[model samples]
Target: MLVAAAVCPSPPLLVPEVAAGAAPELDRARAACFDAVAVLAAARPDRLLLVGTAPEAESGDYPAGSAGSFRGFGVALDVRLGGGEPGPRELPPSLTVGAWLLERTHWQAAPPTARALPDTLPPGDCLAAGRELAAGDERLALLVLGDGSACRSAKAPGAWDERAEPFDAAVAGALGTADGPALAALDPVLARQLHVAGRAGWQLLAGAAEGADLAGRLLYDEAPYGVGYLAATWS
Candidate 1:
């Protein structure tokens, strides 16, 4: 069962090297994400799972020791999930960020298993996957990554949409309270319209957290570059 969870945004910009000169802009988010990751370490789970959104070509299961590189983002940096020899698969951008966070923290709690779910995955399927993931006997912790609405402002990636604010507000609220049902209830149609990449990941979290009495703390909620980036911890 899930013993703890950390929610973070997946933008490549989270890596200072990837962001270059604009790195300072996300310093606060970077700090908050570290704090959330610390929570997972404190939980000392027996198994660590990293879940995120990815393109169809990159979506699938990832074993411990999977490797990820920032070369795709014009940086020579490379990271490997867990600590063993590299697995056969290359992590997608989302899981790459997750691995980066673990490396940044010098994580030693558990070797991580990563899974990248496609953007088009149905809500029901995402939830079912999460439930299945949580059925094992080991104590599990998840580092979930995905972006909220991409259209928070006129300068946002998707440009300003009148409906963006409310949509993100709901998402932020659910993360702050660890409201699994609310997360599972998010309307996929609306999420797609609002350009939310977090829907499937969040729903997966909801499924894993089904009956756990986890307490939540919202550590960050900001859209520095018109993209909704959030950080939270549940324990």
Candidate 2:
């Protein structure tokens, strides 16, 4: 059963070494992520499910010990999912950030499991995956890593798109309220066009929390470097 959840952005800049000179820009987002993770720890779940985007065309399960590095982002920092020994898979940036947050929180109570779903996965399939995770008898918590839209300003990664603001606002609202149906209703085509990578994972969250009575709190919402980054906690 679902117990608690934390929504966070997956930017490599979340790591100080990767962010370099721009490290302080995301200080608040980082703090909010820590606060959200703290909520998960307080919940004392049986296990934690780290859900985020993967480069694969289909969803894949990763061992708790999966390791990944930020060398591609000009940083040699490496992170492991949990205390377990290194596994075969190399997590993508999303899960890597999740691992970093877990490490910062020193997560220990619940064993952690990682699941990476393709960014362009269909909404139905995303929901199905979420449902299966929620079906488990153990109390499961989720650490979801994803970014809203990258087109908030003229200098944004995707360039300024008039549609980006509304799209991001909707996403923040959905996450802040734990409105599963609203998240499920997010338009995939529009999201893709706006360069929003959080759609699939957020939809999966909707599936996982389908019938649960979770209370939500919007911890942070901002567009640092023109990427809409949000953090929220549901308990």
Looking at candidate 1, the ten consecutive residues that score lowest on lDDT are 80-89
Per-residue lDDT of 155 in model 1? 91
The residue pairs found clashing in candidate 2 are: none
Model 2 regions lying over 4 Å from their true place: 57-59
Q: What is the lDDT of candidate 1?
A: 0.92
Task: Give model 2's clash tally.
Answer: 0
| TM-score, cand. 2 vs. native | 0.97
Query: Alpha-carbon error at 175 in model 2, in Å?
Result: 0.9
Residues 22-131 of candidate 2: C-alpha lDDT, one tens digit per residue: 89988999999999999999999998998898777535888878898898888778889887788777888898899999998888778787888888899998888888
In the range 34-147, model 1's lDDT, one tens digit per residue, is 999999999999999999988898899899889999998899999999877787879998999999999999999888889999988898998999899889777999999999
Cα lDDT, model 2, residue 235: 98
Model 1 residue runs over 4 Å out of place are none
Candidate 2, which ten residues in sequence have the lowest lDDT sum?
Answer: 53-62
